[model samples]
Target: MSSHSKSLGEFDLIERFFKTGANSLRTTADSAIALGIGDDCALIRPPADEEIAITSDMLVEGRHFFAGADPELLGRKALAVNLSDLAAMGAKPLGFTLAIALPMVDKIWLEAFSKGLFAASYDYSCPLIGGDTTAGPLTISITAFGSSPTGKAIRRSGAKAGDDIWVSGTVGDARLALAALRHELNLPNADLQNIAHRMHQPTPRIELGIQLRGIASAALDVSDGLLGDLRHILKQSQVDAEIQLNQLPKSITLQKQGIGIQNQFAASGGDDYELCFTAPSTQREKIHTISKILNLPLTLIGKILPKKDVEVRIHLLDASGIELSNSEAAPFLNSFDHFAS
Candidate 1:
C-alpha cells in the first residue's frame, strides 16, 4: 500500500481506531459493550428504589473554553460541568457518555484527555459508560446519569418566600482565572495560576448536595454569574430575595486583588460550582451544623422575601440597612452577554 493510499472511512475508523483498549469505565455485558458502544441504541438497568437524573452539556471550541486548553482538563471539565448540574439536583453520579467532535486523530491528545476524564471519574466514583467519536472542530458533549432515592430529589422550584438564601464556599474564582488568562489585569503568578485552574478545573459540590437533600428547599450550581443564577432561583421559586452583599463568601486571593470587601465578585462574577440554595429560616442552625460537620463553609447571604413588586433587584445594603443600587457601576446578570462576546 502506498503512503498516500488511505481508505479508512467512518466504519473502519470506528472499528480500527476508536474501539481500542477501553477507558476505565463500566462496559456492557460484553465488557466492551457496557451500554452497547456500537449499537444504534444502548440499554441499562437502574437499581431498585433509585431514580436516575440525566443531564447534558456541550463545550464548544472558541466558546466554552479556549482552543489551547489542556486536553486532559477539557475532558475532565466536559464531564464535571454536567455532573455539577446533577449535583444541583442532589443526585449521586453514576456514569457518563462522551460525544466528542475532534479535528483529527491524535493519540497524544486522546491519552491526555482520557487521563483527565478517568481521574475525575474515579474521584467521583462514577464511570464512563460509552461514547461516540467524530471529526469536527472539537466540541465535547457529555450526558451524565446520576441517582437519587425516589421522589427525594431537590429542585429549583421548591424555594418559598421567607426561606433563607445560602451559598456554599467562595465564588468568582473562575471568572478571576479567566481574567488572568486574558491578561486583562496584572496579578502574581501563583494567584493567576490558581485562578486559571479554577476556571479550567471546577470542583462540583456533589457531596454537599447529597447532604442537603432534605434541607435545601431549592438549589442550583452557580455556573453562570451569581446574580444571574440566584435570580433564576428567585424566578422559579416565585419569590424575591434581599441579598446583603456583606454576607457573601470571598477568597483571600480575590480579596487581595481589591475586588472589595463588599463581595462584588461573588455577587456578580460566575463559575463558582458552589451551591446557591434556599431553605426555611428554621433550617439555619441545622445548615450551620452540616457545614461544621462537613468542614464546608456555608454562608447565609440573604433571605427569600414574598414575591414583591421589585423582583430581580439584588439590593446592596450596609450595616445600618442602607440600600445601594448602581446599575451603571455594576451590570447585574451580564454573563450571557459577557460570554456572547
Candidate 2:
C-alpha cells in the first residue's frame, strides 16, 4: 500500500474520487436511468422494448494481479472485463456500480484508479451509477448493466449445427505476456512492451458484438481461454465444435514462439477479452463486411457440430487435418481455473 489517508472518511473519499464530473450526476438525459449516485439505490429502467443485461466481475490483488500493480490499468480492467460480458450478449452499455475494498485509503492510488475508471466509463458511455467502498484486502467488484432489443440478445444456448465459429481480433498475446512476465518463457523487453496491453488494457468488441446481434447464433467473450469459454457455448447449445489449431488467430508476438507454445497459449490462455461467436454459413459475406466496417478481423476458426453424446466435445485438429488424441491435446485443454488443486 502507498501513503494512507487516515482522516478521509468514506463519503468524503467517494465525493473526492468517484463522485465528480460526469459521475457527479446523471446530467445527460438518458431515459433509461431514472436516478444516479447520492441515492440509497440507483434506479434504471430498460429502454422501451429493450431488455437489461447485467454482469459482475471481481478482481483480487494476489490472485488476479500482483501486489502494487498499476492502479490506472487495474481500474480500467475492472470495468472493462464487465463490459466485455455485455458485448458478448450484443448489449449496449448503460451504466455500472462499483464495490471496492481497500486496506486503507491510498490517495494516490485512488486518484489514478478513478481517473482510469472514468476514462473507460466515458469511452463506453457507461456511467458510474452507485456502489460501496470499504476497508479490507484490495479487491474490485463491478456490476455493469446494458440493454438490447427484447428477444434479440445473443445467448450461449443458440448455437446450432452447421454454424461457423468466428473470433474477433487475435488471442493468446495476453497469455504470452503472462508467460514472459513469469519467466516461464524468455522474451525481449521490447516484445513484452508491445503485447503487455493485451493483458493489462483489453478492448471490448462492443460495436462488433452489436453488429453481430442478428447474425451470431451464439456468442461469448474469451476471458478464460478460447477453448474453455467456447465450451460454455457448446454445453449450453448441446453441440460440439471442431477447431483447426492453425486457424486460431494469433498475434505476431505469439506467432514468434514455438508451435507447441503457440497452440497451448492460444487455446487455453486466459485474459484474452476477444469475442468468439457462431454464425450461419450463409452470413459469411455480412460478417466479412462487418470486419471491414469495424476494421476488426473476424476469423472463421471452426464449425458447430451435432452433439455426439451427453459429453460436450471440441475436437482439435493439426495443420495436416489430423485429429489429436486426448494425451496429445492435454496441454491445451486446461484453462485458468481459480480453484484447481
Candidate 3:
C-alpha cells in the first residue's frame, strides 16, 4: 500500500480520495456551500439573519492518539470534536474545511479515514467544502462553520448568580478508557471496549444545544476536564459555584469504580464532549422537558453564586451537600495540562 501510494502525486491523491467524498456531501439542495473542492477557495452563503459560528481543532499524532490507532475512528473524532464546539455555541452545523498533514499517502489508511470523516459529515449535515493535504507528521485540523439566529448564540459570560448548573449525558468513561489503555488501571475486556468507544467516538449534543438556545444562559462542551472547562464560564461570568461531587452524572461503568477514582475522573477527565450549561432556576421544569424530549440525561450538579472579591471559587460539596475543605477537595482539582511535565 505504501509503495503504491508513494507513486501517487499529492494532487492525484486528493482527487482520487477526498474529492469524491467532499462532492457527495453536497447532497442537500439548500446547502450553504456554493462550491466545493478543486477550487482556489470554497464559497458559502449564510443566511442574512443568522450569525456564523466557527471553530477549529487540531489532533496531532501521539499527542492526541496512539500510534497506529484506527484511522477511521481518528477521522470521525477529528470532526466530532469540532462539532462539539459548534454545539457549545448553540449553533447548527453547515460545513467544514479540513487541513491534514500526512507522513505518507497510504491508500488503505486514506480509504478508512475518508469513510469515517464523511460518515460524520453526512450525519451532522456538515459538508466538507475545502481542505489542504500536505506531507508531514500525521495531523488533522478541522474548521467547522455553523449558524445561529443573530443575538441568540450562547456565551460563557451570560451565566448569572442563582442560575442552575447542569450537564448532559454521562462523564468519566473516556478517562477510564484512557487509564486502562495507559496501564494505569485494569479492566475487563467488555468494560474496556465500552469505555474506549466513549473516548474515541464522542457524540456532540447539537440538537440539545439548539433547543437550549433561549433557555441556557451559558454553555460549553466538556473537552477539557469538566471543572477546568467550567472555569471558563465562571471567569467570564464573574461568578462562583458550588458543585456536589456525588451528583456528577456517571456511566454505570464509571460508578462501579472506587469513590476516589469516580471523583477524580468525573471532575478532571477530558474528552467527555458532553454539554455543561447554566440556566435560571425557574426553568428547571422546562429543562427537564427538554431532557425527556431529547432522551438524554440532564443532571443538575451545582448552582452559580455571586463572585466574592473577584475570586471565582468552585466549592466542592459532598453527597450530603456539605462543602468540603480545600484539603479534602485538593485531589480532585487536577486536570489535563498540555504543557505540564
What number of clashing residue pairs does each candidate have, in the order they appear?
Answer: 3, 0, 0
- Where does candidate 1 have its weakest 10-residue lDDT segment? 1-10
- Superposed by TM-score, candidate 2 places the C-alpha of residue 333 at a distance from the truth, in angstroms, of 1.8
TM-scores, in order shown? Answer: 0.88, 0.94, 0.95
Which candidate, 1 or 3, would have the higher lDDT against the true structure?
A: 3
Model 2, residue pairs in steric clash: none
Query: What digit string (tens of lDDT, one per residue) describes model 1 on residues 1-341?
Result: 00112323642453333334233344232322236344554554566787889999998888888877898998788878888998999998877777777787777888788778777877776666667666678888888888888987899988887888899888878777776677876779988876776777888889889988899999999888777888888788777777776667877788887645225566777677889999998899999998998788999888887885755555556546677667632654455333557
**C-alpha lDDT score of every prediction, in listed order:** 0.74, 0.87, 0.87
- Runs of candidate 1 with Cα error greater than 4 angstroms are 1-23, 26-39, 260-262, 310-312, 326-330, 336-338
Model 3 Cα RMSD, 1 decimal: 3.2
Q: Residue 175 in model 1: shift from native, Å?
A: 0.9
State the lDDT of candidate 2 residue by residue for 1-341, as single tens digits: 11135434653655546867445534342457787777677889888999999999999988888888899999899989999999999999988888888888778898899878888887888888887776789989999999999998999999999999999999999989988888888999999999999999999889988999899999999998999999999999999999998999998889999999999899999999999999999999999999999999999999999999889999999999999999998778777663232
| Predictions: Cα RMSD each | 4.4, 3.3, 3.2
Better candidate number, 1 or 2, judged by lDDT = 2
- Tens digits of per-residue lDDT, candidate 3, 181-221, equal 88888888888977888898999999999999999999999
Model 3 clash pairs are none
